[model samples]
Target: MIFIHPTAEVSDKAKIGDGTKIWHHAQIRENAEIGENCNIGKGVYIDFGVKIGNNCKIQNYVSVYHGVVIEDDVFIGPSVTFTNDLYPRAFIWSEEKVSKTLIKKGASIGANSTLICGITIGKFALIGAGSVVTKDVPDYALVYGNPAKITCFVCECGRKLENFEDNKKDNLVKGICKFCKKEIFINKNNFKKWKK
Candidate 1:
């Protein structure tokens, strides 16, 4: 049930799951694995051996380069950039030199954000627009800065749970999401989804 646009170039070796739609002018490379119910937007380029999990939305003009792994239920906003090389040189073509990036499940990457390689963006994290992520983001973190600092903790539905700026050290705050009614617990070191 995969729908590939007529102008799209999908390799025969790529594994596209059911209910996925690849839009116009998109290119899916060999050995790429895309899971079910995903949207690959126009002019998007999925590099060889890149893995994308189920229920994902990758918007227009996104460059999912090699060594990037996207987990299920992720939202990648328009024009997001993923870089693979730590020190890129035009003359050097080394596959082993490229660093890996992992976007965990239920995470949302805002538009025009740049994710540097060798970082694992944790589950349910929200990355704000135009951010340049240089390090690993914790789960349920609301991060937005030039280097992407954790400003707050948020629920899975994108509601801010607690402010880290107001309370910096060793304390716990419990919050209930207004939209989804999910309970969240935030401490100095972790953000947890609590069920009671």
Candidate 2:
């Protein structure tokens, strides 16, 4: 069952999957696709053509504009802003000027983060609070700060992979997570979680 608040403006043309809940004053524009079990928070605006995958938790006041795609299991913290236009002009309106931004599966963005357009946030990556992301984040990376630099590698469980540097040999690094006891293999920019 889908529940939309009385004050929310959800277009009939929008595709809302089952079990989705749209909170107060949320506006889901035409052609926007929201997958199942999503929580569209208060005052959140999902622009036309935006695609959101299943189980996404979009916190209060988040702005998901056109040209943005969020994959499944993503958590967008409160007040997060996704900008589609690289340059602003009050009189200008052009779909060609909007840049694409992708938030891959299982990623989490902390509160008040700003994602500049035209960047891909990789799968299972963690963005700390108040980050200003401007580049493509690698998978399982923990990135934060004004420019969102990758500070360390993290597990899918959101625990830091301690001493990852010590396991590097050739192009692959293998380590056992202390918290979850799961084995992980990192091959350059790609990482995989395996059972022990």
Best by lDDT: 2
For model 1, state the Cα shift of residue 125 in Å. Answer: 0.3
Query: Clashes in candidate 1: how many?
Result: 0
Report lDDT (Cα) of residue 78, candidate 1. Answer: 95
Per-prediction TM-score, please? 0.89, 0.91
Instruction: Tell me the whole-model lDDT of each prediction, alpha carbons only.
Output: 0.90, 0.90
Stretches > 4 Å off in candidate 1: 163-174, 186-196
lDDT of 1: 0.90
How many steric clashes does model 2 contain? 0
| Clashes per candidate, residues 3 or more apart or on different chains | 0, 0
* Best model per TM-score: 2
